[model samples]
Target: MKLRFPTATIAAVTFFASLAAGMTSPVLAEETASPTIVTNLRATPMVPANAPVRFAPPAEVVQTLSVVPAELTAADDSVTDSTTDFSTLDAAVAAQSAAIDDEELNCLAVSIYFESKGEPLAGQLAVADVILNRTTSGRFPSSVCSVVKQPGQFSFVKGGRLPDIDTSRRAWKTAVAVARVATKDLWQSPAKNALYFHARHVSPNWGKARVASVGNHIFYR
Candidate 1:
C-alpha cells in the first residue's frame, strides 16, 4: 500500500525547501548577480591630451632610437715654411724604382745584353719596359720569353737561340743587374710605355711619338 501527502502540504514544503537552499548557499546568488571584471594586460602607454602629436610612417619606425655626440678635435695647423726642396720629389721617385724576377729575369737580362750591353742601366731598363709593354698589349705573347722570340722582333736572336751570355764580361754583369732592377720594377722606367726602340744612328722616322732617349737607344710609344 502507498501513502500520499496532501497537495497543499506538498506546495508549502517545496517553497520552504527552495528558501532554505538560498540561505545555505548565498555565494551562488552573489556569483550569478556580480558584474564581470575586465582586466588590461597590455602596457599600452597613454599620450596626454595636451602633448604635441607626432606621426612616423609605419615603415620608418620599429623601435625608439637615441644618438650620442662624437668627440672632436681642432684641425691640424697648415705648414707655413717654404724651405722644402721640390726637386727632391723627383729624386725620391727615381730612387724608389727597382727590379722585377725567375725565367722572366733571364729573358730580360738576355734582351738587355743583346739590345743594350753598351747602354747605361736606364737604357737597359727602358728596353725591358718596351718588352713588358709589348706583352701586355695583347699583340704579343704574354710571357717574356715568347715576347722576345716573336717572329722578326729582335735582330740578335738567331734560330730562336740567344748567343751564350758570358758572365765574366763587365757588360754582361751590368746587363744582368739592370735586368734584375727592371724585372722587379725596383726602379721606375722613364721609358714609360715605349713599346718600340731603335739605335740612335737609325732614325726609323717611324713618325711615332718619341718619349725618351736613354744611352744610344731612342724609345717610342
Candidate 2:
C-alpha cells in the first residue's frame, strides 16, 4: 500500500518539529541566567550531647557567705569559754563571800556566831540552814532577822537584840562565810529540812522526827 500527503501539509509539519527542537526548559534557563553569590561565613562547632556544663558563682554571692553577725559569734563564745569553778564547799563559800554585805546576811552571820561558834564548820552551816528553812516555813516569820530574833527561840537573844561580837576574830570571819554559803544555796547542809535544833547535852523530848546530828547539836524537822 502507498501512502500520499499534500506538499503544503508536509511543509507545515516539518516547520513545527524544527521550532520544538530550538526551545529550552523554563527552570534550566532561569538557573543558568542568575548570578552566583558567595559569603565569608565560618562554620561553628556543635557541643556534644553528653558534655558537662559548669557556671562560676557571682562575686557578690561569694562575699556574702563570710558575713556573720557579731552577736551570734559572741553568744557561741560565751557558752564554750566559761571559767567559773565550783569544785568544793570552801571554794564556793569564798566565791560567795565577796557579795554578802546585805542586812539579812549580817543577821544570819550573827546568829551562827553565838549559837554554833564552837561547833564544826558543817555544824555552823547547819544552824544557818535551819534558820533559813524556818523563814521559808509557814510557822515562822518571812524575814531572816525576824526568824532569828523571835521570842523564846535562841538563848543568846536578850530583849529582841543580838549581842556584841568581836569581829576581829577568825571565828567571826568563818561564820560570815558559812552564812553566805547557806544563803546562796552554794553548799548542801547535812541538816536539810531541819526547822529546829538543840544542844545534845539536854534532851527536849521534841518527839519530832530527827533529821541529822552535826557536832554537838541535834536537828529536828
Candidate 3:
C-alpha cells in the first residue's frame, strides 16, 4: 500500500525533528553558531621547542648589574698609586712606611744594607730590584731569603746564614724603606729586570747581557 502525507505536514514534521536535535545537544549548536571562538584558538601564537626563554629580572638584581666589585676598585686604586709621580726616587723611598717585622722583608732589607748602604739611594733600590727579579727568574731560589742565602751568591751570606745587622743605624732605616718601595713596585728600577749584579771593582767574567751600571754595582740580566 502507498501512503502519501500532505506537503505542509511533511514540512512541519521536518521542522520539529531539527528542534529536537538542537535541544538534545546545545553545545554543538553553540559551536556551529559562534565560529570566531575556534578561529581565536587556532590563531594563537606558539613558541618553538628550541626557542630561548626570557624573564624580567628582579629590580635589585638589575640595579647591581652595572655596579663594580669592591675588590676590583681597590685593585685599580693600587695600580694608580703605583704609577703616581714623585720629584725623585728619594721622595718615593721617603713615602714608604717601612715596618721591618716580616722575615722575608727583613732579609731583603739586610741584603740592601750590607751590599750598598753607602751607595746612593738609586744604587740601593737597584740592589733590591735585582733580588726581587731573581725571585721570579726561575733560575734561582723562589724566595728572597733563599736567594740571599744561595751558595756562592752574595758575599755577605756566611754558610747559608745572614750576619747580625745593626738595626739602629740610619743606613739600616733607609734600606728598610728601599725594600718596601721595591716589593710594592712603587717606583721603576734603573736596573730593570736585573738578575745578577757585582761590585764595580771586580769582573766575574760572566758572559751575560749588561742592563745598567747603577752606582757601585753593575747589573746583568
Superposing all C-alpha atoms, what RMSD in Å does each candidate have to the true structure?
Answer: 16.9, 15.2, 12.9
CA lDDT of each prediction against the hidden true structure: 0.73, 0.84, 0.90
Candidate 2 lDDT, tens digit per residue, 1-221?
87899999999999988777666466677777664421222244568999999898899988898788787777563343234446776776665543346889989999999999978888999999999999989999999999989999998999999898888887888889889778767678889999999999999997999999999999999
RMSD of 2: 15.2
**Candidate 1 on 1-221: residue-level lDDT in tens?**
88898999999999999999989788887786665532232345667999998887664354323333343243332221122222432332243323333677778788988998876667778998899888888878998899898779998888888778677776776666676555545567879989899998896789899999989999998
Give TM per candidate.
0.53, 0.61, 0.63
Report the error of model 1 at residue 134, Å: 1.3
lDDT of 3: 0.90
Better of 1 and 2 by lDDT: 2
Query: For residues 31-72, could you state the per-residue lDDT of candidate 3 as single tens digits?
Result: 787989878988998889999999999999999997998877
- Indicate which candidate wins on lDDT: 3
Q: Roughly what TM-score does model 1 have, to 2 decimal places?
A: 0.53
Model 1 root-mean-square deviation:
16.9
**Candidate 1 off by > 4 Å:** 1-101
